[model samples]
Target chain A: MTATLDRPTAAATGSVVGAWRAVWLRVEGRWTWYRRHWTASLLASGLQPVLFLAAMGIGFGSQVRPGPLTDGVPYLAYVAPTILVSGLITVGVTEAGLPVLSGFKWKQDYWAVASSPVSSGQLFGAELVWIALRLTFGAAVYLVVAAVAGGWTSAGALLVPPIAILAGVACAAPVMAFAATTKGDGHVFAAVNRFVVMPMTLFAGTFFPVERLPLPVRPLAWISPLWHGNELVRGAALGGLRWWPALGHLAVLVALLVVGIALGRRAFQRRLVV
Target chain B: MRSDEAIISGTGLVKRFADFEAVRGIDFQVRRGEAFGFLGPNGAGKSSTMRMVSCMSPRSGGELRVLGMDPDRKGPAIRARIGVVPQQDNLDLELTVRQNLQVYGRYFGLTRKEVRAKAVELMEFARLTDRADHDVQPLSGGMKRRLTIARALVNDPEVLLLDEPTTGLDPQARHLLWEKLFQLKQRGVTLIITTHYMDEAEQLCDRLVVMDGGKIVAEGSPAELITRYATREVLELRFPPGDQHAAVDKVRDLAERVEVLPDRLLLYTEDGDAATTRAHDRGVRPISTLVRRSSLEDVFLRLTGRTLVD
Candidate 1:
């Protein structure tokens, strides 16, 4: 009976449409895994952000009277948008780092997919897309909860989720490029969390103005994508962002994202193709 | 694209890692519906060659074609037609058995509906319907291996590439896998397999190449290779371990060739019974004796001077 089975026919050619479909296929795989295991990551990506908002925006806001740094706004409102961007950045970086390494070294699921019709470039693009989707979901949840907590003082705050997603891709793409180069047991990912992500979250003007930082350390925020995202999110949410500076921040984030994607594509091809 | 043309053909195929050459200038052809094999020990370049053919690894230097298209320019196109089961089962431990098949099918551009149906059929083929919804981590080694094979078939590939298909499987599991593979062969699917097991090669391969030190040392049907490199039958004589050298001197001229192993001495000749009788006439009886037909193992040992599995 098995002898009557016909061989599966191959696709006619590697057309552009086929390539795009392959990319979405990888995205679907990631979505499948996310659906099954998302609860394990919910605390880190979802609950932790809300807890931070509660502790820092409400608890800490009550201690600080309205001031210049707060732009005469309540501390909860001033800190809400910044936390939204920072939280998405955290989720983005976390998703792109160790998981990317595990895809290559531990689980080797990347290799398994690469053996099929999917190209390395498509795999890299799908990873960034999945990270962006995750960041979008996490940021949207945080925005709704913050709004319920009275953190939304301006109608412009509605734009923060999309901006937060851009910040996430900007952060995640570069980390994924670096992650593709890692062949170890996640020591690099741990080091990145400790040395790069933690410091950036604390010092990227999330809670206050960057000018108050020590002069030498202040430039660090200038180069941080999170800081630019923070400024944009806060400006849009607070209704006082100057047009030129917001455009400048957007340009920097876009430039970083482009460079990150280019590097990541090349790195994935190098690691996966051989 | 002619039906009579080779499905995979390579000339001067080479793969170098850093300064080390894993596949040194080798050549071969695989036709449609033929079961071909690469038989070698670990690091003998079998996996490297398989990777190159699968289009997962670009050739360091070679003129290669799969399905009549250049791999360098048409890897995804070529890969879409071929299935690969890697040496290590990289099944997603977090996903259920069914999801693993579904996700892999999607990579080949199969739609959700198509993959769903294909996954169901594959679950039946792999005999994992009972464990279809279970996580892959807790499944036994045989189940995982079978699942990997079933997943590769999700696309119904015209060619299936299996790397050491049953290396770590138990005897029963190995037999089951071999049975499935034989079924695949009967369906006229071109199979490219790499295994260090001579029994597996003999059982499944229509033609095969023996590799050692990154080179193809011999290539033919298993029977042809055995006839060319080994005697028709082997006489195994076990003596005291320390006295094997002495026994070899007594029975040296009785067979066409002799191999001295740690625990036994093998006398290779056209007739094992004659060789054993000759050994007995020489008054060299010390331990157990047995006669068996020559197999691919003896051929491999003759060509490479080393065991396939070490």
Candidate 2:
């Protein structure tokens, strides 16, 4: 013990490499836990999205014709890309809420990490990095399953997975901020799922075009990141994506992501550093 | 093992919550390789002081230096060399017992090979080698506590801060933990422990401070505090509930001081057996009587006029 105590660890140096090493170690902690429980997470993040794609894109799309709303692509092709992004919205909301709060109040792993050399900002960055990785992996699995089910119409569909990942993180970051403010009680997350997440997924132009809805309710889709994500993905997959609307969608998602990251970082710092 | 050099020091340290002060202005220093303790009851700010020293909480309006570095600025560097065992065991339940140690070592940026080797050594030291592969959630209270301590040592820290390390453990478990801490002290790790248990302070600390209402009432070694604040021995006499006050008046002049409890009257003196004899000769009869050596509890009672544990 005396010999080991004389040898300083990397964090004792307080160098940039040491800071990034702390972040990577935190990510490794999450990965170590995920290794044992990947089966359940795979079911939620991967299989569920593919199942939704099969059920809605094939089973339901057979009844619909190529209409102006779908830009003359097959209904399966149109619905596949939107479901990919919307499925991630559900995954993002689920991942961000209870787990973040549990890390603070119940399991208290965040507090455990807090006492270590790791700073709160570094922990926040590691959490988002891990979330982004999970979204990327899940999107890849969903896209492969969709291609097997005859959902891909063009090589342009490769762009949808990256777009889905951006939107998933955009939704997750702000919800993580809300979770950090909650006390141990999980009822608020249930309300978020019931009142906010469910409605947003349903009306975010995922199932049908927002144009078919009443005039007054159209702004609801316009304000949703998921709706923008759905538009960008569907447009790119079917080869009709225009430049100006694409940039607008990109800007909306990026703005949400930047704002969400800022709030999430501050919330984690306030909750943990105290 | 003690030193004249102070490894940790604070000057008029204060900690304020939003509307309440948890640690009022107080000053103390800890020498290297010594078992130092903060003895107080609940809400006495012992834990707050420990947090400040561990770099987990910032002091509100005072200077605190741990290992000659400012905690507010050099927190990560200082924390990298210190281990904290919080009041509660916050072990990672997602990992096995061994992984808990390994992963905690990684937080300090230790290499995977180093943590793997360190985990095995610590598992043996904590007596958890048999339970190494088992999940942390199913371990008993004592095992979890031992593992928490072992995790704190993953960095081979120079100082270990234990906040109420044995609050909820059974007696046998507590003795086991004390032995482990004693070993650490022998190996030259500076220990700063906060506990409400007087006997634990007596057994572990070479020097300590008695805190009440977030202020230091007395500071000395266990024997020195007993000599300074209290008599060498104490005589306890328990009568029927209402008769203790009458007994206190009868034994008032026979001892240095007398404390009247609802059920018992205490006589503070240099010789407990002699005091019991003198009181018996004075015709102060009681249901039960005993003579004992004075302890830290007696010193705390004398200093603050209150018991150390509620």
Q: What's each prediction's clash count?
A: 0, 0
Q: On a 0 to 100 scale, what is the lDDT of residue B269 in model 1? A: 91
For model 1, what is the alpha-carbon lDDT of residue A67? 82
Off by over 4 Å in 2: A1-17
State residue A106's C-alpha deviation in candidate 2, in Å. Answer: 0.7
Task: Evaluate chain B of model 1: give its TM-score.
Answer: 0.97
DockQ for model 2 equals 0.45
The digit string of per-residue lDDT tens for model 2 on B136-217 reads 9999899999999999988777788999999999999999999999988887788999999999999999999999888888
For model 1, how does the per-residue alpha-carbon lDDT over A17-91 read when each residue is reduced to its tens digit?
366676787888988988999999888777667888999999998899888879989999999998888888888
lDDT of 1 at A251: 97
Error of 1 at B152 (Å): 0.9
- DockQ for every prediction shown: 0.50, 0.45
Model 2 Cα shift for residue A6 (angstroms): 11
Candidate 2, residues A68-123, lDDT tens digits: the string is: 87778788998899898988888888889898898888888888888888988788
Looking at model 1, residue A143 earns an lDDT score of 86
Provide the lDDT at B43 for model 2: 91
